[model samples]
Target chain A: MARIEINQSLCKGCALCTLLCPEELIKIGNQINENGYFYAVFTENGSCKGCALCAKICPDVAIEVWK
Target chain B: MSEKKIFSRPKTLKDAPFHFCPGCHHGIAHRMVAEAIDKYSLREKTIGVASVGCSVFLYDYFDVDVIEAPHGRAAAVATGVKRARKDKIVFSYQGDGDLASIGIAETVHTANRGENITIIFINNTVYGMTGGQLAPTTLLGQKTTTSPYGRDFMQDGYPIRMTEILATLEGTAFAARVAFTTPKNINMAKKAIEKAFQFQKEEMGFTFVEILSACPTNWGLNSIDSMKRVEEEMIPYFPLGIFKERKAADVL
Candidate 1:
């Protein structure tokens, strides 16, 4: 099993993570974070492969992945 | 089953969050350098020469010892530091405006003199910190704050390909141009950066890596579109590849 955690406060809502996640488990939420950006959030689906593509593409370095 | 962490922030990076603009490539570039330093166990002896511009605060982001240099003089300062302390791994993180414009003479001379140092050049095509001014690497017909009518070849000479130019110098041991818009490209870029550092560790001559980065805010594009620009617009002008890799045997 694999999972990912995104530090919402550190995210700047670039959406690069949402685009790079091969499993498509990450998304930009409607509500903005403390930084006034829509921050990325994991959908928590059981399909995440923990490839860390999202973490790699993320300019904010806000994602942490575990498997 | 026990959980294992697959990915996290690099140890070389400080706990403070980055102050770069949203979607900036500086963050990714920083991570690449930090990871390379960690892999080589050079964190303790690395000295980073921070250049002026958007990345001026590199001292704050990277945990390694960093010295701020005057505008466009990072390569010159790095030369002094490396000469004074040969045991330290010295590097200079510079932007297009810093490396290709005012600092061009120093950059060329440093590499030509065979200084054993690493240079991380970020070519985002515009002066990001100065509100989108025309840079030496700016593409033809690309509009900037100063070049409102698009960059005319006659008015502003052609874009300078620093990597290719430096690769021609005998002193340069490694020179490559890379972009991290995709996972495959990012992987390649990481390898190239690590190789640059590795070459330096082996006491090879000057090493250089020019990264085609994005300036979303300055380019008037959104984050995703700016990254796409790096792929479609920038890569065409500045092809990605290892232009030169000199073997120590060749020098002998």
Candidate 2:
């Protein structure tokens, strides 16, 4: 129902988005991106309520959500 | 006849739906800027230029005619805007990277020239818009992306206290550093910003506010922790108050 996208190279792995997401839709994965920064990945695509909380808490401007 | 209280947020800030996490001061800063716009009634006529750091979307956050500029170039662009239209209240919103780091040349030169504009400088110590990297204002021993262990004076150099740096420049009409650590501090910051705007509105000269903001994500702490760090660690490095005030003289 909702779509979430993260600029992998830009994601700073802050976990702020992961912590702020009430739906528990975002998380930091073990994989490293081109920038060597650990990126936060959308885990529960089904739970994301298109709230834009990830986009708000993201310090690096990494996440975006659309429904 | 009673005036109704407008118990509502600005139309530009969207709903209670914030993208920022717990304890983030960006929400508070956005509200303050909005409240200033409301107090001054400059939302329609004033134009704002957003810096390319943590508050890069300041234009999105502030209720005003907005324009985007490259990192650290907001002052230069705002300079051009103010010069072209003296009637409009032009302001630049920038973060530490955009102001103190990459844009230092622009910032200094703009203030030195006495551009009739107000600058809101949000200094959170690190390069927040990118990563938890060392910035010009990062504390001496703070850890950041570039300084994995801690900032070393011998190698990392000294943290820049920008208000003090700008105060000595004759072109600076007013410069101050204020914090948003608590409600009292927030009110002080608002008052300082108001005076800075009043300075420009009176065609006084360049005015700048170095606001000690919170960067929880970059600091590797929760939002409350970030605010605490600012009060405890960062404040010692970057002291608060009005470093310079030519407006006080001009009033005489």
Candidate 3:
């Protein structure tokens, strides 16, 4: 199993990670962060392959993945 | 279960959050630069010159010494820093407006002199910090605050291709243009940055890497659409590749 963490405060809700994730586990959530951006959240943690594509494509570096 | 950290932030980058808009490529570029610095263990020896623009507060992000230069004067300031301390690694982070328009002379002259410094040029097409205005590298027919009806080739002349222009100078050691639209492109851009920094470490002549970045806020596009704009529109005008690479024998 892999683990993914996103710093909510730093996430800008760009959703680039959501679009790039091969597993489609990341998504823009309705809940807003302190910065007011909707922010990205994992939909199915078990489905994450830990490819780190989301972290790699994230311009904000808000996502971290561990395998 | 013992958890080994598989991914984490680069030590060279501070823990503070970036002030750049969401989806802005500056953060990615900063990460790549910091990674390179960490890989080469140059955190203490590197001195970055930040030009006037959105990245003016670059000093706060990088753990190394960073000096703020007047708008478009980063190359000149970096040149002076390198000369004063030849043992130290020097780099300048500049935007399109800072390098191509205001600091064109300094950038060109510094490269012509073969100064051992690296330049990371971020070309987001428009002036991102001071509002979206037509920049020197703004694509023809692209609209901005200043060019309300789109950038007219007749009035705007044409988008300035600084990488191509700099490659012609004999003093330049390496010059390339790269984009950051997809995962593959981001990896390529990181390699290009690494090569540029490596060239400087080897005491090679001036090196430059022009990164075609995204400005979603100013471009009036969503983050995803802005990335599409870079690949679809910007790449056609600003082709990505190493325009010049001086071999060991070619170096003076």
Candidate 1 vs 2: which has more DockQ: 1
Give each prediction's root-mean-square deviation over alpha carbons. Answer: 0.8, 9.1, 1.2
Between which residue pairs do clashes occur in model 3? none
lDDT of each: 0.93, 0.76, 0.91
Worst 10 residues of 3 chain B by lDDT: B1-10
Which of 2 and 3 is ahead in TM-score? 3
Number of residue pairs clashing in candidate 1, backbone atoms closer than 3 angstroms, sequence gap of 3 or more or interchain: 0
Considering every candidate listed, which one attains the maximal TM-score?
1
Residue B246, model 3, lDDT: 83
lDDT of 3 by residue, B16-134 (tens): 89999988989989999999999899999999999999989899999999999999999999999999999999999999999999999999999999999999999999999999999
**What local lDDT does model 1 show for residue B228?**
94
Each model's backbone clash number: 0, 3, 0
Interface RMSD of 1: 0.6
TM-score of chain B of 1: 0.99
lDDT per residue (tens digit) for residues A1-67 in model 3: 7878999988999988888888888889999988889988887657777788788777777878777
Candidate 1 lDDT, B1-252, residue by residue in tens: 999999999999987888888899999999999999999999999999999999899989899999999988999999999999999999999999999999999999999998999999999999999889999998999999999999999999999999989999989999999998999899999999999999999999899999999988999999899999999999998999999999979878
Worst 10-residue lDDT window for candidate 3 chain A reads A42-51
Worst 10 residues of 2 chain B by lDDT: B1-10
